[model samples]
Target chain A: MSRLRNRTKFMNKFFKSAIVGLVIIAVLIFLHFIGWLGPVEGLAVRIFSPLQQGTRAVSGQGKSFYDSWLKKKDLLAENSQLREQLKSNQIDVSRIKALQEENELLKKELGFASESQLKHVAAKIISGVADPYSQTVVINRGQHEGLLKGMAVVTENGVLVGKLTEVGDGFSKVLLLTDNKSKVAATVQNSDRTAGLVEGQFGLSFSMTNIARNQQIKEGDTIVTSGLEGQIPKNLLIARVESVKEVESEIFKTAILKPIVSFADLSYVLVIIP
Target chain B: MWYKYILWSIVIILAAAGQVFLSSSQNAIMANFDLLLIILVLLVNLSSFERVIWFLVLSGVIMDIYSSLPFGIFMVSYLLTAIILEALFKNFFTNRSFYSLLIIGSIGVLVYNLFFLSFSGLIYYLGGSEYFTNWRYLGAIGWQLVNVVIFLALAFLFINYLSKRFKPVFLHS
Candidate 1:
């Protein structure tokens, strides 16, 4: 009988506590919806930013060390490949520089805006994929760095990464191009310059879809931003075509893209201030 | 005691920090590790319902601050998970043994994923956002299940073999 009474008392306390918890959560949701939680969130972000940044720095170092130790053989092969690619790229750079000057002169003559210059802000990635449903990375720079929503983020080598979705005082969240919600107007850098919409597939890979069957897109084609979206600039490298899927009945064809940069191992990303 | 509350608060904060650390590593394998969820599930089995509730709310709040999803998703998922865990502990898997802990932890992971996925789907359905339902997500849950079980088993071994500080204490209703 005493045990039964103790059980009843415990049950009462449990119900009361759960009810209180539900109310607190509901109130928080309401405050967030009404935009009253921004200041509080900003304060929290400020407090946590330093800690997250420090942690990320340490973790990145540790991960790289461990990865190198584990994949020494693979690293050796990759290093040689990169060295060869670097030599070829150096040649291409010189060629592109001349073309860039000629293009600028043409733009001046035609009264078109030159796309050669862009503002770049370096930021460290503090966190990646805060939740399962989204593919985002939080960077250390935010409003303090003049970052705003829809600003393009990229890798150091000028590969398109993502765009800022949420900008706080101290940190900003970049919605990666691999997120299902992310879609970029992309063009195949082939002779035909075929255009399509590059969409993220389950945060794992990317696909260039909505390509008209008549357009001549093939494997090994480079995909780059089309600058159709005002925020993201043109000619930023996105991915490469891995395979093209064609169907007789479907009006459009899709191509699987292989991302040049691994989204999971990103340590630093540059935010374009354009 | 007041001191206990403060200590647990610190623990919850550290758990949140651990989540940030794990997410920052950028390793695909580490990405599926849910530190906060595992902590909540473990706390539910080891502590009182009220204490678990306290930790749940704190964890939810901290996670929500980092998440881009609408507020209350973490809170709701964590709350419902706590309730389910508490109920499972009290009514179903009542043994204070390794087997019971494994069962409870597995169920907790599954329940939390179910709630989180469903809420996310609902949000997307209502035009709040977009999320892809893919086979990889199911595979991620499978990995989490394996991870939690391995973690609990190792923890159980460490407690039973190495230390008595965190021995399993059965909760009483």
Candidate 2:
């Protein structure tokens, strides 16, 4: 009877200590979740950022060396071919000038709105997805650089890859469009006629669903953001149609698409922090 | 004993560093080997339940600090895994056969994946989306299976090497 009482006392003390420890840990975790623990994150980034930068610098230098020493002849040949084409195409000067003016006008229009509305913060891709299972990439810019969550991240070529999901002090996580949770309001570029949603299904591909089967969608058509919700800019390249599947029971047809930017080769990205 | 703790801590730190550095490289494979999970299992098998619980708490704190997920998720998962292992496989703790480790490690991997998937699904549901619609849960499971196979083979080789080097320490008299 005495031993039983002692055991009960021990259990009570143990439980109380456990509860206290758990509460303390929980509070710490909560503080870390908010911006309160920014210093720690900053320190971590500082310690690790240099290593990434060093690796990139080394790789870049190596590539430049290879290009100069080994690929110089090929580059020269290509340059001469381009020069010949330019000479042959000289008769279309007026048409080329008109096309260039129109292109400039369009670019200026895009630049004005994109600059005013969304604060475009340019960043380089420090690293691609760390894990095969996660469709996340890391960018050099972070909260200190004015990056925030929900920022539409795009490639330099204006292809939408993802959005900034998490921000540290010096680094941020870009949730790629290939992630299963990613969804964007998109439309057919050729027609600007059909509007639908683009969603990532967790593989190498994304899918556009809820399009009417009768819509004149083809295999080679381009899809871009509709910008209906204003989360992303209008006409940003999303993907190219790969396959169209018609389901008897479903009201809309689904089209599988290949994203414009190759995620594996992603090196630099632009974060649009509006 | 102090040296052992220091050594293990260094190993964990190194493994985490490798995970962080390699995760960024363009050519590096994204699949992660659950170093924490392996270490936890090994420690629990070699130690007492009280010690196991303490280690679980410590490891949970470290993982919480390092992981991208919400802090308590891994802590809860690791604590539950430790408890389950202790309760169910107390006898198998002494059995260090390669086959046993493989089977046990595979089970651990499955449980870990299921826990995370269910947790993510719950989060998604609360956030107002169909959880299973994103086929990532399936993909993660497949990837984790591959991770399990690699871990098993590597663990077998590592444990065999360790046993040979420290036969008296690992083997029961």
Candidate 3:
């Protein structure tokens, strides 16, 4: 019985506290609605506004940073794609340039062949300096194309380049005029039509020897094949006389010659079909 | 084994073709570079004797088909070079190291040139070709040595990198 009474006493105390708490909450609500708590609310808002704004600013910056990252990723992909396109365009440009060069060479060759009324076969150089010991080039046309041994090979401008030394079925090897083994009967364009044997010296340059001391030869005089050799035709440009050497004790005068066409740049040539 | 031989034969043919292409005068240094010789030198150090011999013979035959040199000239040169390389690998360069490769490759180039030039001279004396030896020919030998050393070094580094990256590790029991 005493325990029941103590429990009731405890419940009464709890009810008293709850009633007081309810009354206080109701009074605060009334004060808030009647503007009685305005200064305290203003003070609380002023204290929390900076933190709220900081959170909002952080979220905005994160969103902007994420947007910029996405943009950068897209730009990188676009840049790589553009780089690939540029590489392909560069290859196309080089191909077009090569085709243009080949076309120009063919046109010039056609012009020369048609003007001279010479029997010829157009051939492209397949390889250059095939022989380590000799300055030789392999041509695409060979015995199959009626290119025989000792056939004269010339450039598009009718400049004598070499002769077919080794002729295979589908390919022919041309011994370039710069080769030491190369020899040609040439005549100067001067009045005397000075006869000399043009020989390659060390695969570097040409020297026209066996010239009579009385023959007048000077620098800048054009040297052409004299048609003395049955394989080579007459009046094909070989070289220009660079300098002439005369010695009274020597039996023959020699003239140093310079080839106008570079052997390295001989991409296409014409085989004079004898 | 058969497939390996076939692969090597194909490589030899390709090397021959590459030689023909590099022989062009468009680039002088590349023209002087002997890709086949470099491959042979490398192969001698790595492969078995029988396979190396087969490669050497194939290389010589294919090169002879394209070369203006007398028949059997390239074969002799390549064969002798293989023999020398084999001896050197067996004796001095037993271990497969970069320095060993460099030394062997350098000596191989020199030996090949010596044999080649000597044979060329013999053939010229016998009235086979019009080739005349000059100091400039020696320069070609030097360039070929440089090319061989560079190629061997690059190949060594690449193979080493690949081996290290993909090596299978055996765990201790």
Give the alpha carbon lDDT tens digit for every residue of B40-129 in model 3: 888878876665666766566555545555545676787777777877886679898999999999999899989998987788677643
When only chain A is evaluated, what TM-score does every model earn?
0.74, 0.68, 0.59
TM-scores of the models, in the given order? Answer: 0.74, 0.65, 0.61
Estimate the TM-score for candidate 2.
0.65
Number of the top-ranking candidate, with TM-score as the measure:
1
Give per-residue lDDT, candidate 2, residue A172: 83
Q: Where does candidate 1 clash, by residue pair?
A: none
Tens-digit lDDT string for candidate 1 (B60-154): 87788788676678889999999888877877787768999888888888999999989877886785532222457657888999999999978
Candidate 1 DockQ vs. native: 0.25
**Candidate 3, lDDT over the whole model:** 0.72
Model 2 regions more than 4 Å off: A1-25, A51-119, A127-132, B1-11, B20-32, B47-71, B89-104, B128-173
Instruction: Tell me which of candidates 1 and 3 scores higher on lDDT.
Output: 1
Residue-by-residue lDDT tens digits, candidate 1, A100-167: 99998875764312233788788987665458568888888878788888988988767888888888
In candidate 2, which residue pairs clash?
A: A132-B30
| lDDT winner | 1
Highest DockQ against the true fold, candidate:
1
**Candidate 1, CAPRI quality class derived from DockQ:** acceptable
